[model samples]
Target chain A: MGDGPSNEKGAQIMSLFEVLTIIVPSTLLTAAPLIFTSLGGVFTERSGVVNIGLEGLMGVGAFTAAVSTLGLEHAGLGDASPWIAILFAAIAGGIFALIHAVVSITFRADQTVSGVALNFLAAGLTIFLVKMIYEGKGQTPYITHNIDKINIPLLSKIPVIGPIFFQQVTYTSYLAIFVSILVWYIIFKTPFGLRLRSVGEHPAAADTLGINVIRMRYIGVVLSGVFGGIGGAVYLVTITSNYNVSTIAGQGFLALAALVFGKWHPIGAMGASLFFGFAQALSITSQQIPYLDRLPSVIMLTAPYVLTLIVLTGFVGRAEAPKADGVPYIKGQR
Target chain B: MIKLVKKINWMTLLVPVISVILGLLCGAVIMLVIGYNPILAYQSIVESIFLQPYYTGETIRAMIPLVLAGLAVAFAFRTGLFNIGVEGQLMAGWLASVACAIVFGHLPRVILLPLSVLAGGAAGALWGYIPGLLKAKFKVHEVISTIMMNYIALYTTAYIIKNFLYTEGERTPTIPAAASLASPFLANLTQGSRLHWGFIVAIIAVVAMWFILWKTTKGYELRAVGFSPDASQYAGMNVSRNIILSLTISGIFAGLGGAMEGLGTYQYMTINSTFTGIGFNGIAVALLGLNTPIGVVLSGALFAGLQTGGLTMQSNAGVPVELIQIIIALIIFFVGSGYVIKWAMGRLTRKGHK
Candidate 1:
């Protein structure tokens, strides 16, 4: 794969091999955050709550992770700071999400409107705190202990798959994929999952079955917060290595899109995240590829969004959400 | 007078007023928690907007696009659709208006100015029409589609500018005087602020929204569909068509808002790495305004004041400008959870009776 090609076919094959090595690992890195956040979306939406504020939740997570890591590193935590910061992010994200859960659940406000408010609040509050904490700076300073990539010991020695999957990758990516499968099990195979889905599908029926509708929804929303927080932290430590207003950008929205595109299933969401991540990878790597570099960069830049639109138009009519999704549960109504 | 007072809907009037006060209070609390003097912060905001001519002018200038953006969101809300694509539509409009102005630089102001603005509306409408069409035909959700389109607009517009209108400073060349909305008279009146003639256009858009939503048969059908799509369909109104029309009209308002920024405020389009955020703020504006035209104007001015005045607060009171954002967000939350307010209000009225 490294030497000069003797023939045209050999050169094409070598390039393909080279491209795979670069693209696969990058795709995993990019998809890791989305995988976590979209799984969060899956939980929230499946419990009949719509969380457009995942973007804001992610922002809160990123900010918390950055600040905590910096603080912990200053406290002489060494390499453990970033990992511990993820837990802090999850707590912050969960607390921030409680605002959405309370407003939409207990207060029975318009869920979408509440979610929008949550986004605004998260964006505003995080930056406001940043300014207050960082001596009026608009962003946080970069943390010293960013999470590093590692190759799996035995797996990195395997022939083709080694370099692509097990080499030079962050453990967080594997954790994200693993969590999605666990979420699928928890959401599909468990009685708790049954109650959660039942509440979303038909709250009155679920209520009749002695299920606590409001409590289930609250749990769903908080879980989303936890997962989304981890996602944001992972992105911060592995990719951005700091927190800024633009650090999370539209990844949360992309995760939401993945959730919808995946038809609200956890594994399906993970698959969709991978696809979107692949599109993102293509855009970033396009300038490096010989033939792809010639095309206008906008095509690659907008591919994920454009492709999501196309995919939705083609298949979303059949993509049904949970029956009572976005509807607040009221006692003894209808 | 007493009878007329009794006939009024106090809840509508009280909810927003209380929400604003509560939002400000929340901002104050946050500031105090952060070791800043909230009183000084708010005082500076008020003083700057009222006492300084430039800040006053800037506040009004800022209100122009905000008013139009609020109308876009409110108009769609009234028609039972969420036009989250306003950001994308605004970008498309910004690009189209500037592109038109630059290309038609030779035309008279009477022809070129309106043409450029109309081009913006057209571009926005076209951008809006896609999601509307998809929703109408394929049942695709507009929220997700519009969100996707925002990115598409961001990247696509950046690409177009880089490829075709490349110039120094990473932005397009300025439009000719004929197409510019800059008014020397307004600038002089505002003490050399960036105030422009777009204010009039925003006022007209507000009135247009009110007229179209309340005075026309099409508007009636649109509102009916919004009230109940199934009932409207059974009553022989075209639900799908109303949905499409609602989003398209919403796009026009959003696009015009963009034109205000492109032709009036800046006079050229710069590639944007993120959304201008006027669209998202429109949601807060519309919600706080209760989706009414008169209400939108008042809320738009209030938000404009906060934003412009926030700079003064930041400079004068050692407070951050983001405090204003927190205040606005709190207002949206308070307004959205009107249930809580109403419940409390109910208890207060009962106590008064006792």
Candidate 2:
């Protein structure tokens, strides 16, 4: 009888560990897309181009990925469908982003307004196309094949850390992490990064140095599109396995918030994305926790956004945008 | 001839007109590509909005909130700010008005209705104040703060409705008739349409917006700051205070929009999982209207007509209502690229001179 109580306590500790294993893996999966998209935001904002149309770009990517995967699967590209879809999505996203570039850069349209319009355009066009393709339906057919989780051969056999990080994790998540680090190095350590930063900070100075400000800005915007597209495609193939109007809902915005909350740094954005991912995972799994069940789930739902606002107000007072950010560069005007 | 042409303000009128035409033309091309009759589609839309009394009333009813929301955006734009939190502010006002109605619903119509609306406006003002204060105090971008505030308002209101005001089926109880904006006289006149007293409220708001923006000394300060904040600061104006006041007033308009929906249209608040697209649409409306008082109402009417007519077009012409959204988006895109249109027009004029 005395051993009964101790046995129950031992089981409780085991269950707690089990709970974490599930939540932590899910959190990484959820955060991978945000990290990629926010890194994209970092690239564009660092080059003095404001990309509020990441949501639209992501939507384009998600829709294109789903549609292309369906076609490729039909053509008998069984295991390779998702990979090919990602490539197609990235291309579509980069092409779509050129609209924002042409409007905001070439025509000197208001960047914010152009972004808003792009979102509406994306939503409308996607739904319209969906209806046309699906014979007056609102969504595409379900994707049969999805990206699978892979276990790292020997690394996943290690202790708790292995299960949390390597076991049963999507390859896309690891790729996202690697890309975040790679983007950080490129932004901070490369000559290209220096030129991009200089153009964002002072276009006149960059122009004086013979750097093509407009061309650099276009490349930054297109890079943002590529990363954001990949992020959306990853989210679709790994998380949802389908494309609808709501597939990329507000994730792009969440990524943007993460970008700003991370103070426009690649590494910081990754951390913020992971934090948001953890919060989302908690919200999904909170019912299983004894104490968490008592708390309202709305708090968790609002946490990422509210926490971002708090961070922006509290810690990021000096989080300055590049000086010439959002201004249309007119030659010889300054 | 030059003086006459200069006095015409052609640039202001031309861009929006040309953009609208271009949007419609593009919409037509899309319909043609889809093997639908664009002319029939457009005619059905026009007939439903104009000839049908019920649809006209519905269109006007829809315009009430949109006009106010546009004013909300336009007000902030005039003060050199973007108030994307209109969605959040509108939502806060919606819940506050409904909550007030539930509490004070026993009172007479005159007292309860106005009180509930004022409560809503006050709640929205509070919601708007957060980002404005953040911008002024911490140098936080209003854009980011306002966007965050939107989600916060979204989840917070959903929680409030679920926990505190749960009537049934993810919606609150309808307000008492005493506090409702529904007018039997207006409804009967409009063939049982949902038109209400909120139309009067919208007109009053428009006049008030005009007066406050053009007639008052505070208006001058707001406009001056919008022109150049540094210049206004050097001229002894408090830039931060103006920013706060501008956002606060914008919040009032947006909050009133929510109040119109609650007391006027639905007569209750439902939990919204997604943002009501009206806030984003208001940005387009404000842009189309050139942020002017009268222009906002006209453009609001135009957009509301498209929406109301879109339903009829869908039913009659076998065209999906999504086409209207595409058209609207195209209009915004064309409007955003007005400089291109201006350049093209300049070339045309120069060619005529040759």
Candidate 3:
């Protein structure tokens, strides 16, 4: 696939159409899990709870999916059932999320520490589980076979956005985008959205207005867990297609960055996620691009993180958080 | 004397002890649920950390960095800066020291070792200063910058080790004997094992931190700024300069932590891995220590004990080393919830219990 002055696809200057093809398809594949995670962050932060453990939650979810796929394959289900494996991953990720929720939200602990704890927890636990399950092997079985790829025949042929992008996009990307829209609508237009936002912006005020702040925070956290779980499962199945130690890597943090970068808006989060996915995909494509590839590898790995730094530093909601995100909302005595 | 003892910050001492006990109790419950032999695991943990001298030495070795890392966090905590880049700083220190060793391989130990240590500290200071500068100048949150710095540090350290520092054969050059600070005397104390002068260095570092943080006028300025930057500014303190200084000193301590691991312990650095978890561990150490130098040293040693013994629990008791990590999480969770502990204490006191 060396496109540099070598052959047919190589010699032709990359058209905007060709660029969109390569960028879009890969962007969605990478963006799916990020969308789910950032969306989860949106809910949590909006409801006034910061979910730092998204990384750990995703790690646990990814590992659990891998383990479940193998266990299911061993249990006569065979490797053909990606759905079952993904389901198992969701459950595992949820359980992991629950650990963070219970520790941070329920117990009213420092959210950051709890989040960091989750990362360590997942790191240690996953490796330990790997040792136990694989005995000595560091990874689970490959999954590209079972992971289904969607093919929208007609949609695939559309000019710039079709074949290269739409045709190869995973089912999860579509689901993630839909979920973002759905979350935005629910958060903005629905009664529950107002309540969640109210609780975040001013928990005490919301409580005065008869909203259950604790309950809302709990709901927000639980929902976060669900999204995180989905993020993990989708990451393994759609993006990596196999589970290893570093499989989950920085995706959870990327989702957090997307959440911050998107200013906590669900739809905006989608755009932010696409940007990150494009940057990440571009890092790899740097090898193919003539002048772009000249950038150092260190800079390439750092591109996404540096972008996160810039976005968080400059663009995040400097206005104000929903007043009581980190503070534990007491019932009354205030 | 009794009255004075009562006046001392009991919370500082009791908090960690109480949390550790609670953590182990919770861990025991988890172990029971998993159907693991909790008793055997606990026995092995104690044996590994306390009963065996060599094992204890390993724990102390681990604690050196933990304490230093903890001091790094506590230094910022005192200033309300919450320097989260300790991990990044530690990595920077490790990279700087290792690079020094590689580049200045021919110097005598006297110059080489001191220069290497200084280089590590300087690198750490540089890493710490980035976020400090960002916060001081642009109002960019140090938390975000430091976290980003961590990712940058990880990848860069990995690249440097893999591409630049690794010997021609792909593995890094073995640290020369003269360059290594591992001492036979210290090793004998640990059953002729890997224990070294680093532990002593860690203690000395802790004392120095204590002096810098408590006795010095700069320390007073930092604490004042922590309480109220506005007030400190009114009192003629340069808040921005303090921010930068706080981070620089913090970074130096973290660099020393890396030196402990590198010159004193490993003698060579391995990259592309999670070599800088010490920075994260420092947060916990700072919390456990109540941001006091002595407390941090104690907490760091305890954490080191956990690390070394946890490895033992993995190899000997067949308990996953991750169990220690769970204990750590539980500890952090409990520490963060001081109100919960205070309430528990209040209830127990009311009930006429100790």
RMSD of each: 2.1, 1.8, 3.7
TM-scores, one per candidate: 0.97, 0.97, 0.90
| Top model number, DockQ | 1
Where does candidate 3 chain A have its weakest 10-residue lDDT segment?
Answer: A312-321
lDDT of each: 0.90, 0.89, 0.79
DockQ of all predictions against the true structure, Cα-based? 0.80, 0.78, 0.53
Q: What lDDT score is found at residue A151 in candidate 3?
A: 74
lDDT of 1 by residue, A1-334 (tens): 5454557778888898888888888899999999999999999999999999898889889999999999999999989999999999999999989999999999898888888888888888888888778887888998888888889899999999998889888888899999999999999999999999999999999999999999999999998998889889889999998787788889999999889888899999999999888888988898888798898878877877887788788754567789999998989888
Which ranges in model 1 have alpha carbons more than 4 Å from their true place?
A: A1-6, B1-8
Ranking by TM-score: 1, 2, 3
Model 1 residue A55 CA deviation in Å: 0.2
lDDT, candidate 2, B18-70, per-residue tens: 99899999999999999988999999989988898889899999999999999
Kindly list the per-residue Cα lDDT of model 2 for residues A1-334, writing each as its tens digit: 8799999999998888778888888888999989988998998889888888888888888888888999999999997999999999889888888888889889989888888888888888888888888888888898998988778888888898788778878888888889999999998999999998998899999999999999999988898888888888889888988888788878999999889878888998999999999999899989988688888899898999988888877664555677777788778988
Task: Single out the weakest 10-residue window by summed lDDT for candidate 1 chain B.
Answer: B3-12
Candidate 1 RMSD to the correct structure? 2.1
The TM-score obtained by model 2 is: 0.97
* Model 3 lDDT per residue over B125-179, tens place: 9988888887887676676678778888888888888887786544456666656
Chain B TM-score against the true chain B, candidate 1: 0.97
Model 3: C-alpha RMSD to truth? 3.7
